[model samples]
Target chain A: MTARGGIDLGGTKIQAVVVGEDHEVLGQARRPTPTTGGPQDVADAMAGALGDAAEAAGVRTKALGGVGAGSPGIVDAGAGTVSGARNLPGWEGTFALGDALSRALGCRVALGNDVQVATDAEFALGVGRAYHSLLGVFWGTGVGGGIVLNDEPWLGRGAAGEIGHVVIERDGLRCPCGRRGCMEAYAGRGALEIRARKLEAKGEKTKLFKLMEEHDRPRLTSGIWARALDQGDKLATSLIDEAIAALGVGVASVVNVLDVEAVVLGGGMGVRFGEPFADRIREAMAPHLFSSDNPPVFEIAALGDLGGAIGAAMLVA
Target chain B: MTARGGIDLGGTKIQAVVVGEDHEVLGQARRPTPTTGGPQDVADAMAGALGDAAEAAGVRTKALGGVGAGSPGIVDAGAGTVSGARNLPGWEGTFALGDALSRALGCRVALGNDVQVATDAEFALGVGRAYHSLLGVFWGTGVGGGIVLNDEPWLGRGAAGEIGHVVIERDGLRCPCGRRGCMEAYAGRGALEIRARKLEAKGEKTKLFKLMEEHDRPRLTSGIWARALDQGDKLATSLIDEAIAALGVGVASVVNVLDVEAVVLGGGMGVRFGEPFADRIREAMAPHLFSSDNPPVFEIAALGDLGGAIGAAMLVA
Candidate 1:
């Protein structure tokens, strides 16, 4: 029985998993991402994680069929390098991640961006299983998305499906990408925090700041936001509403142009909010649809944290 | 020699052409559209136009291998019927246009929407020939567009490439399609004329009214607008600028999402303004592009008036 190795290399954490031919996870390992050691150090951590995962699965690294990794930022898949990943400190410029991983594991390796890999996973074995065309949106620190067309990922001119960068407002909020009015600038978790801070400064009644202070965290996590919403926090609710509306505009444009059959929501924020958030997005997107009578199906992603790893493995499967 | 028949059925005119396998025009005919006689009358006119074209080519209708027609409105290509064609009176609901034309011409028939067929023509033999992925935008009475991905038309779900309906402004201008903030609401010829009339009623100095009166036309034509712009009409220039800006936002969103290799501008307004309009669009779209450094090539569409006919023929070829 052949086994495949997969890694989801994120900003704060690196998750590695070994899966068999049936898509069942044979073994898994997790570790804090090394930010101080630069790209080489991060690559070494990935190698170690893969080794541990393979050992736990009772398989030799050299015996694995292939390995795949999903990272953050603009990835040149052909060159096997990642660039423009701002969240991963010391992880800039072109890094031959695939080559390094392949050398460490002694097998062929493939690479893709996190959102793209997650989308591929959803399309293959999750909520998007029934649709040939789909748009997968993941709301986390930044709102990112990927598109699958005719059972293949539509990577136009190297960098397609920048749904977060789609400008919803002409001259609205400033995005981290140096663009104004991008969907990310409005719907990202960072955006929500900014709004929360502003509303607190204005003396508006809210439990978000108090909760954050109690936890002693600089940024509110998806779990905290969910808890606040469940507790009926006014500021949190309003921020979520704003995010939903902005997300709706961007998603509606994608749906109207691509005419995809399904839109799957994933990532920390998306899965945390769950059905309520999906419903809001569907309702807000209805008015903007060109074909309002026949809109795409909106659903929450099903793969959970294993989506990126599963999707990455499938890249070489 | 084998020849194929093509027809462009518009609201005011019916154009038919016979072309050889090499895409050379063998024969062509044009006639005023029959509006009073209903869908059946329009079908008869299409048959008559094809007969005339085939006779001029000195070929029997039965000898032609295939015939294709491009019509206005929502077309069910599989069923060969057209619906929601508001321009053609009594052409609502569904008409079996392909069967009607096939019965009359004694050959297999194909059907597509006007914009989709025109885009196919441009992609296959015109400005978009060099690009594998393309977005073809046609500015006329309404702003309609078509997308070609991997050298094939992307008819998503049922109706894809509805770029005009992509909402740019939140609750902006009211669109004829009962939507707000659509690109067509601000950039279509009908939208431009509506703006002109409103400005004129506000006592603004403009050459649009003068040009319309001089030509004895109720509505301003593309040529009239072009001449007015050349003659230094402030109103016309401003309107064109506004239209270009709105078009840029909508187009930039598409480019940001799809990352097509090229964007070909065509139809009455696009051709009339030519390079100047294309330049303005490029400039306005730059700021909104996610990949601004490597933007898609913007070009004015070639193929002139025969684009629809040529594209239709290619559908069957």
Candidate 2:
């Protein structure tokens, strides 16, 4: 079984893995994403992460057959470029990310959208394996989504499955994408953090920021939220309630349109909150559902944090 | 050339068509749906309608290759049955509609969903021909949607494209389906009519009901709406404006999930108001769009009222 390398480029972390045939992880590494660098520096960090993984796997980086990476942005898979990844610092225009990675690692590099790869991994070898059609809802920095229809990815015009932007209200709260009334405006981690800070500035009593500071997190990380929930932070619970309501509307609305057999929830919050949160989202979806009698079942994505990197590795496979 | 018969069963009327090998309509007929009868009588009317069209085409109904039909409800295409068609009078349980029509007409029968067939027709020979992926939004008594992805219908779990049920608000207006804040709650003709009557009872001024009475229509049909708009009826225009706004959010929301290449607007309201209404909906969709830079284009369905029947005929073809 030949070894292949993979990378997952997120707003907070760069994850890398070296996998052998059958997708068993041979080695893995993780590094915090640079908060102040441009695309080139981000690309260098991704290369370094892969190199660390290759070293752990007892192989030279150049000895691996190829490497695959999942990155945020509007990806042109054919062109190996990423554009408009506003979540990354100074990632303004298109960058040949694949080429850059390949130059540093001495092999071909395949590029995919971050969430799409994670969804693909879940569909291929995780919770979505039993279903013919599945919608992978990854609730994280921005509530991203990916679709698999009839056992194939349905990337309509190359940009399908943008569920976070579904308008849950007409002209409501502003979204991170600059849109108003989007599901992400209410439910995305970035938006939630922004909302929390706004409320705190206006003298709203809350332990969310305090918890983040205690944990040394630059943002309201999922771990801090979990801690805040345990302490029964008023602001945290209230915002989480709103997020559940918005997610219910958004996810249920998608289920009504696609009617997939299953929904696999992933990403940061989805994994952290798990069964209880899924149950709440299900209860929320019940009212908005049109085909309530024959609704799709829900599952937490089974691959955990390494899903995107593993999926990218499979691109080489 | 060989001939085939097609039928479309609607809430108000039954439409039938006979087509040649080239799919050119050789004969057509229309009849009022029995507002009181069960599925058996409805099947009989469908048979009779096809007989008239076959006669007009100078062919015997039994001599045709086969006949196809588009009906509202959950269709079991393999079983040739329709179930829970609440739009039709007293159609509660499953009925072997294809078998009944086949027995009466002495030919094999094929069945499909009405909105789906209309969407298929548009994809095959109408406005959606140029599109690789399409979302057909048909706004009639109820807002219905049909989807085509990668040149095939995406009927996930047999009940996809229920776009009317997509929740647009958190616990907003109650829908006819007993849900709150559905797109159809605001945009459907039935909902709009209900809202208008409610407002009129509350002393809201408008000529909607007067125009409906003058036209001798039991319901506010599309023609009456066009006339009311021409007369600048405040109540009618206000309701229409709400519909446009709701359509914007609903359609944009669907586009966010699918990112389809095109959207084909059909059904009664969509056809009557045409391009101007489409433009208004487009403007409304702009703000809620996730992929604002590369949005799907919109168009009116080109097949008019006969689209469904023609689409059903193609099933036989």
Candidate 3:
């Protein structure tokens, strides 16, 4: 029986899973991502996690066919190098992630960005399975997207699925990517936080600040935003509404151009808000649709947190 | 000795061409479109033009393998029906153009919208041949677009290339399609004329009105616009600048998402403005590109006026 190892490498955590030939998750393990260590340390931690996961599944490392990983930032899949990854500090420049992982595991390793991997997983085994063409958008630190066409990721030219960078507002807001009025500038978590800070500076009272204080966290998580919304915080409600509107415009442009069959919303914010956010996007996107009668179906991603790990494993499988 | 017939059915005229197996245009014919007649009369005119073109090519109707037509408006290619074609006043709703033309010509009839057919022509024999993924945009009475991926048109779902309807401005000008701030609402010929009229009403000195008076025409043609721009007409320069900016934004959004290898600019306006227009669009699009270093190449469609006819013929060939 053949099995595959998958790793999801994020800023905060590294998740590893062993998937059997039957596509069942046999075992999984996770560890806090080491920020103090360099790229080699992170790679070693990933390798250790993979071993623990395979051992937990009662499978020998030598028996595994291959391993795959989903990492943050710009990924050169062909060269197996990662760059521009802010989350993995000091992991900048061209790092041979695939080669390093392959050497560690003694097997071939495939790598893709986290969003693309998650999208592949959803397309193969989650809500996107029934659709021929799908666009998966994950709204976390920044808005990232992946395209699945004919059950394969449509990597146009070299870099495709930069939906977040697409301009939604002309000269509206400055994006971290050095562009003005991009979808990410309006809808990304960073953008939401910027608005929250501005509102707080203007003497606007909100439960978000209070919740963050209680949690003793410097950054506001999706959970904090969701709790504030639940508590009827005006600032949180307005920020979310603005984000949803921007996302709607960006998504509408994509649908108008590509006319994909379905769209899956994922990431921390997307998963937390769930159907309500999906419903708002659907409503806002309706006006811009050319094929309004036969519009694409909108759904929240069903795979939850395991999507990246499952998708990475499937890449090698 | 195989020959194919092609027809370009537009609001003002019908262009027909006969092409030999070597992709050479053997003969062609054109006639004024019948505005006073019903759908059948227009169909008869198209069939007559095809006969004339075949005869001019020194080939009998029986020698022609098949016929294809590129028409205006929303086309249901499978059903060979055209709908929402405002240019053809009485040809609204579903018109079985393919069945009618097929019966009249006594051969198979393939039908597509004008932009799609033109894109096919450009992709097959013109500037887009070298690229794997291509986007063809046409600026005429209204903005229109088509996509060619891997040398085949990417007709998404049922209606693929509605680039004109993509919103560039929120709550801006109203489009003929009952939408606000669509690319067409800003860049289309009608949109430009509206701006020209408003500028004239504000007592702006312009040669456009004078030229229109000299030509004694109610509508401004691409030729007139070009002449006005050449003569340094203030209104014409300003209006064209605005159109270029709007087009740049729309195209940038498309590039950021799809990241096609090349973009082919066609239609009357696209052809007339030529390199200067292409240059402006390229410069304006540079800021919005996610991959600015390796942006998609922009080129004017090389097939000239016969692109529609040739593409239509190739559809059957």
Pairs that collide in candidate 2 are none
Q: Highest TM-score: which candidate?
A: 2
lDDT of 2 by residue, A1-317 (tens): 57999899987778899999888889999887887879999999999999999999999999998899998889888899999998788998999998999999999889999899999999999999999899999898889999999999988888899999998988789998998899999999889999999999999999998887888888887778888889999999999999999999999999999999999998888888989999999998888888888889898889888898999988888
- Please compute DockQ, using alpha carbons, for every candidate against the native two-chain complex: 0.70, 0.88, 0.66
Residue-wise C-alpha lDDT for candidate 3, range A1-317, written one tens digit per residue: 58999998865568899998866899899875676757888889999999899999998666788888998777888999887776565776778889889888888899988888989999989999898899998887678889987666877885778898877776778886778888888888867787788889999988898898897655677878999999999989988988898888788878888888999998768887889889998898888777788888999998876777888998887
**Order the candidates by TM-score, highest first — what do you get?**
2, 3, 1
User: What tens digits encode model 3's per-residue C-alpha lDDT throughout B151-227?
Assistant: 66777785777888777776678777777778888888877887788879999989997887798655676778988
Q: Which candidate, 2 or 3, would have the higher TM-score against the true structure?
A: 2
Model 1 reproduces a share of the real contacts of: 0.72
- Give a tens-digit lDDT track for model 1, residues B234-309: 9999988889989988899889889999999987788778887789999989999988889999999888667878
List ranges where model 3 is wrong by over 4 Å: A10-15, A29-64, A86-92, A99-108, A216-218, B11-13, B29-63, B100-108, B198-205, B216-218
User: B196-307 in candidate 2: lDDT tens per residue?
Assistant: 8999999999899999899887677778888999999988888999999999999999999999999999987898899999999999898888888888989999988888
Candidate 3, CAPRI quality class derived from DockQ = medium
Which candidate leads in DockQ? 2
TM-score of each: 0.89, 0.96, 0.90
> Residue A297: error of model 1 in Å?
1.9
